[model samples]
Target: MNKTLIVATLALTLGTTAADAKTRLLVNCFWPSSHFACSEVLPAWIDEVERVTEGRVTGIIPPKSVAPPPDQVAAVQKGIADVSVMFNGFFGESVTGPLVAMQPFVGSNSAEAMSRALWRTNREFFADEIDTVQLLSQFVISPAELYSQTDTPMNSIEDLAGRKMWVLPGPLAEIAKKLGSGVVSSPAVSSNEIISRGVVDGHLGLDPQAVQAFQLMPYTKSTTAFSTPIYSTSFSVFANSDKWAELSPEDQEAIMSVSGEALAAAFGARWDKAAAAAVAAYPEAGIEVVEADPAFEAALTEAAAFVTEGWLKAAADAGMDGQGVLDFYTSQLAQ
Candidate 1:
């Protein structure tokens, strides 16, 4: 072959090698495309992962979620997708650690504090329960609150009698039932339809941004805010363990450097901003937001105690120091 032909062949091989060197990961986002989780956090994290790895690895989210919110964990674990974000409570008895964050009144107003605390708590106590997947990060979104379409604000326990309240799964629902509220349950994605169609009188456990996202403001007449949130939803970004193992150790290290608590903090901070913006726009949307009265608060405190006691009992049965873990998480928030 001529010298020019040899040079051209070498260039073609080099180009092919360069293309094969890039690792592209597909993220099966559970949140809607319009949600900040999909719209902001996921993309930002993807960019960070690629940048930190010096372009060795990159991630892409589909224009729409490949799996429903509750099914994401299963989808990723079964290798139907390489990555996913899952809500721990949605899996029922299958996973346990995220319950620490889901515990009523256990979270702070500061999403960053709650998220980082949950990350630390998971590291210390919940790893075994979550060992099925490679955890990229853990987060507690906004603290939970109630929004009602009612004649008057929900100011006391008496006001809850027989009123329909949409409750998320787990302790929050249990608490609502114990308080004499008629519980209607549905996922956050369907909240707008549920309320708009008068399927339920109100929802019990969504953050302000979620409420706004679902366009719940028009149907919701009153929002009862607690001194501390009623509950928080725990979310985790994870990858299929097999897929995660395929990455080079250096790439894994580079990706993780931008994950864990730092990733959680960034997600939490964005959630806070979204919640604040949603809450700020409430009046313009004609929704009445009110603080829970002291009497109502006392009742909530009693209900929280009941729920926490149940959780602690369950934790002890699992050979974990439930109160100790809770105390440590709360302490971390103070710092």
Candidate 2:
């Protein structure tokens, strides 16, 4: 071969090798495209991953969720998608440590603060709990509140007992059941069906943003606010373990730099802004808000005490000092 021909061949080979080296992640968003988790949070994180890796690491979210919310973890594990988020509630016995964030009356009203605190708590205590995937970050939405669609407000245990309620599954559902409310439990995404049809007289598990996102405002007449939130939903962002292992060490480190607590904070901040906007629109929406009476708050707390007790037992069975971890998480939120 001529010298010029040989040089050109070498250049072509190098370009092909570099192209093959790039890793493009398939990130799946289970929420609707307009939802912040899909529209903003996941996209922003993907942008940062691409930026920090200098184009070596990049990701694209599918136009629609690759699987239903409950099936997300399994889909990722099977390599159907490279990345996704799952609600911890759906995992049931498979997940325990993260339930600390879900304990009734434990989490803060600020999603950002609760998210960052959950991440720190996970690192300090529950690091080994989630071993199925490459854990990226953990986040909690703003606390869930009790909303009544009837003429009566959920001011006391008796009011709650009289109404049939739709509740977000898991701890909130369990709490409602224990309170003797006629409970219809399902995923938050499906709340519209039951509420719009008047299948339930009240709802027990949605933040302000969720009220707007899920279109629950029209059916909701009033919300009884507690001194602390009744519960919050916890979620995990993760990558398929095999796909994660395929990345170079440098690229992996770059991704982590933009994830972990940083990603949690970003998600939480978006939630706070959206919740604030929804709450600000309440008056025009004709939604009434009333603070829980002090006596009523204490009574509700007493009724919901079993949720924490159940979690503590599960945590202890898993060899975790459940109360210690809970105390640590709450202390972080206080800061």
Candidate 3:
């Protein structure tokens, strides 16, 4: 063959190779499509991924979640979905590093700050805690406040003890149980069913945005805010290890440029904004909001001591300095 003919053939082969090298990720969102995470956060991150990688890497959210919230990490591990978010609470002892952020009365109300701090702390310590998937980023939602549908606000441990409460599974549930509150523990997605059905007289595991998103506003008569968050849920944005490994080193680096702390900041900012809107609408919705008196706050602090102790023990068992890690996370929040 002539030189021109040989060159033309090589060009076509290279073009086909480039096309075959492109990757398309199947992203799953457990929340409703109308939710900010599905509608905005994931999509925005996908856009950045594509842009940074020059269209070599792209992702799309499926019409529905591939698995329930608690099973998200497993689904990704089994390759049922290429990427998804998992709530840290669902894994129990399987995931301990993130529990630092979930400790009662520890985190700030600002999801952005808390999220960034969690990511940084995770990277520096306990990085091996989650080895099943490629951990991409981390975030914490706004801190949960006490919301009651009962005759009176839950201002003290006695008030809380008097009512059966629905709480987000994990630390919050444990805290309520310790406080002598009759507890029904489940994922936040189930909050509507339990609250609307009056399965519990109060709830203790949702930020204002979640309260609004889960449609619990109608069922909640009063909200008692503490000096610090009663509790917060931590989450991990992760990808299937196999799928992540398939990407070229250059593309992987490109994607990382827009992930980690950048992604956490984006997700946290959305939570903060949505929560603010929800809180501002409280008056119009007729949901009475009251700040917890110092006595009430002190009572809760005393009751929640065990949660912190348990976490510190777990961290030590995992060969981590639990108190040091916790101190680092809280110090980052103050900054």
State the C-alpha lDDT per candidate.
Answer: 0.84, 0.90, 0.89
Assess the local accuracy of residue 86 in candidate 2 as a C-alpha lDDT between 0 and 100: 90
Model 2, global lDDT: 0.90
Question: Which residue pairs show backbone clashes in model 1?
Answer: none
TM value for model 2: 0.95
Candidate 2 regions exceeding 4 Å error are 2-12
lDDT of 1 at 59: 87
How does each model score on TM-score?
0.91, 0.95, 0.95
| Tens-digit per-residue lDDT, 1-335, candidate 1 | 99999999999999999767977888877776877888898889999999998998898889987877778888888988888888877767656566878777777898989999989988888766777789889998988787778767787887775688888766778888888888877777776777888877877888888888878888888888888888888788899899899889999999989999989999999999999999899889888878889788888778768878877887888788888889888888888
Q: What is the C-alpha RMSD of each candidate to the true structure, in Å?
A: 2.8, 1.8, 1.7
Question: By descending lDDT, how would the candidates be arranged?
Answer: 2, 3, 1
Local error of candidate 1 at residue 272 (angstroms): 0.7
* Candidate with better lDDT, 1 vs 2: 2
What lDDT tens digits, residue by residue, belong to model 3 across residues 1-335?
Answer: 99999999999999999776779999999998888899999999999999998899999999888898889989999999999998887776778898899888899889999999999999989777898899899898888889999768888879998889998777778888887899998777778998999999999888999899888898989999777888887899999999999998998898888989999899899999999999998998789988898998998898888989989998899888999999999999999
